[model samples]
Target: MGDALDIMQIAGVGAAALVTEMTRSSWDSMRDAVARFFRRGGEERAEQELRLIDTARQRLVDNPESGRGPVEERLHRALAIQLEAFLQAYPDAAEELQVLTDRIQGTNEGDSGGRTTVHHNSDSQIVIAGGAINASGGFHYRAPEGGR
Candidate 1:
């Protein structure tokens, strides 16, 4: 909306949000936020965008392999193009687009609104509550390729 480069950058951020957040637990909220942004166009346009988002998510759910490969890249490009066109049509919505993108990034970073401190010495072991673990002064063994 501001310029060709700015619009493309905004679209890239939007597309990255869609692609990366689609498989995460926050996806429903992310999708709804995206729909709200698109709703600037109109009800019909918002619904159509929602459908496209859902279709992309469904593809990932139905075929997990595609989520990390060429299919994912294609989806990113498609969404970026769609968003760029939308921004071109509605130039004033660029600010809201940036806010939404920031929200997605913040959510992904686990916004707990507090500081977490970890104190560890060379021989210390630690485990955070949410699926994170560190073992110090030990031989580390990697898992097998196929979910061992």
Candidate 2:
């Protein structure tokens, strides 16, 4: 609506909200809040939008080996379009959007936020809960041809 960058920003915000909220236990409330922001056709419309959110989650879950980069990119495009259209219809929703943004950020800042970690060999990643992350010198190994 505004410009390429502006629309992308709106889309990024939407994507971030979707990413953050889908993991949270209070997902329904978060979904309802976002729906209310658009003030779309009411509760039913909001529920429909929530279905989209669920689809996004499924994409991430179903494509673990596919890497998150490509998945996130696709989501960004879809969410950006949705956000741009929604904002165009309800410019005042920016404040409501901020409310969700702050809440997610605050929630993450507490015990529920993201932490940095790198994992090897296994399918799990090491997560830092409350303290600073630590690392040592790099380690690398070459699998012996057909050996371990």
Candidate 3:
């Protein structure tokens, strides 16, 4: 009888330990899943911003001499401002978007003839240049504040 009681106590403790370990593992997985969810959300926002920038760039290219007197400038400024605001809302993915923006802007500026070619590589880095204005240039990313 004494040996049986000892065996039961040991089994109880082992069972308790297993339950505790299972609970801990479940919590850890939940936490990781939540973190990934937020990360993916931020990435989606960043991609949206990139698309907006690309659209704006295409518009500029299509109507370079549109006599809307400074319309292109205003549009570019608005896009930048809006994108910066978006980045401020999602700092986690801001770095990549910022790098892309800077590269595009630099390429646009260096091209004296307002005609530029853009090349996006598999690595997510883009190169832009006018017919003969191909000096080495690159972009860097910046993060926004308040987790924006």
**What TM-scores do the predictions have?**
0.71, 0.58, 0.32
* lDDT of candidate 2 over 39-114, digit per residue (tens): 5546676677667767887786577644876787787677767776666666666556666777876776775455
Which residue ranges in model 3 land beyond 4 Å of their true spot?
A: 1-41, 66-69, 91-148
lDDT of 1 by residue, 1-148 (tens): 3498899999999888778788788788778788889899999999988888799778866666534677778889988998899999997888999998888877766754547677654444444453345658854655558862
lDDT string for model 3 (97-147, tens) is 434335434544554456655565333544454444544674654555654
Model 1: weakest 10-residue lDDT segment is: 122-131
What are the per-model numbers of colliding residue pairs?
0, 0, 3
Stretches of model 2 off by over 4 angstroms after superposition? 1-8, 40-44, 112-148
Each model's lDDT: 0.80, 0.65, 0.43
Question: After TM-score superposition, what is the CA distance of residue 44 in candidate 2 from its true location, in Å?
Answer: 5.1
For each candidate, C-alpha RMSD in Å? 9.0, 9.5, 26.2
Candidate 3 versus the native: TM-score?
0.32
Ten residues in a row with the worst lDDT in model 3?
A: 14-23
Superposed by TM-score, candidate 2 places the C-alpha of residue 23 at a distance from the truth, in angstroms, of 3.4
Candidate 1 wrongly placed segments (more than 4 Å): 65-67, 111-148
Residue pairs clashing in model 2 are none
